[model samples]
Target: MKRSKTSKSWMNEHVSDIFVRQAQSDGYRSRAAYKLIEANEKFKLLEKGMVVVDLGAAPGSWCQVINNAIGSQGKIFALDLLEMHPIKNVDFIQGDFRDELVLHELENKLNDLKVDLVISDMAPNISGIKTKDQAGIIHLNELALDFAINWMKPNGNFLVKSFIGEQYESFIEAARVVFTRVTTFKPKSSRDRSAEIFIVGQKIKNIEQLNDFGLE
Candidate 1:
């Protein structure tokens, strides 16, 4: 089958992308690793012996970044709906993150280990319909937030990708209420045309203060 113009253009751009070339030479799985690298540089979030949860971690680029930053002492729990090749120390879970059973299995794998950081690069599969895409991404962001609230260690941080849209303010407000500080970042690695931004919520408040945003 002939590739659509969009797909062909994406392929061309991917080939020409500096970050893509850098990722290839650096032995990372994808260019997405640079986003996490830039975010961590600014926030100083990853530590040598922390436990982390990576939602939508397919291709395992972010997991690679986490693995390098945290070293062998740290633990990574990575979840994705699609299959991912194993990363040396990452515990990969294949399932829909929203499903009750998947959540149970992930928690079981964690064995009640408190997560020191939760990062999500999840975005809905784009259908090119703006409203629907926005809604879907927001829902994923909420799920990421809920997971952080439930599983985070005291003073843990949550970093998630979010798009600028009608839901943006409400989402930031919601995060502010639960975290001691909430800030937004647009990594240089993210395309200039893309509206995607990272929302970093640091120093979480008590879980008792959380409003029902869907938690187990």
Candidate 2:
């Protein structure tokens, strides 16, 4: 089968991408690992022995990064709708985290450990239909945030990938309401042409208080 020009162009660019080459040489599962590394550099989000939850963690590059950053003492509860090959220290749950059974299994694995960071690299499979893709990503972002609020340690952090769109500011505002500090930036590993940006929420406000205000 003949490849579309777009697919051929993308393959060429991906092959030449510095991050891609580095990921291949560095034993990271994918180029996405650098995004988490850069975010951590700026936010000081990861620390040795801290507990974490990773959403949409297929391919496990971010999981590898987390495992290295936090070490053996740290715990990682990771979930995705897709299967991920095992990473030595990552506790992976392969299922839709939205399902009650899946969530229960993840919680069971967590064993009530308070998560110091909740990071999501989750993005919906793009169908090239702008409206549908945007809605799907937004829903995933919301679910990640809600799960973070319930599971995070006091002053824990939340980071998620997002794309620029009509509802973007509203989501930022929503995160700000839950976290004392909220900011968004594009990591160096993210493609310049991509609209993707990461939202970081630091020093969470009291979850109980958020519930009292119905913010949760």
Number of the predicted model whose lDDT against the real structure is largest: 1
Q: Write the per-residue lDDT of candidate 1 for residues 10-38, one digit (tens) a residue.
A: 99999999999999999999999999999
Best by TM-score: 2
- lDDT, residue 57, model 2: 96
> What are the per-residue Cα lDDT tens digits for candidate 2 across 115-204?
999999889889988888888888888888988888888999999999888688889988988999999989888999887899999999
lDDT score at residue 14, model 1, on the 0-100 scale = 93
- Colliding pairs, model 2: none
Clashes per candidate (backbone, < 3 Å): 0, 0
Off by over 4 Å in 2: 1-3
List CA RMSD, all candidates: 2.3, 1.5
Q: What is the lDDT of residue 79 in candidate 2?
A: 94
- Please report, in order, the local distance difference test score of every candidate based on alpha carbons: 0.91, 0.90
What would you estimate as the lDDT of candidate 1?
Answer: 0.91
TM-scores for the candidates: 0.93, 0.94
Could you give me the TM-score of model 1 versus the true structure? Answer: 0.93
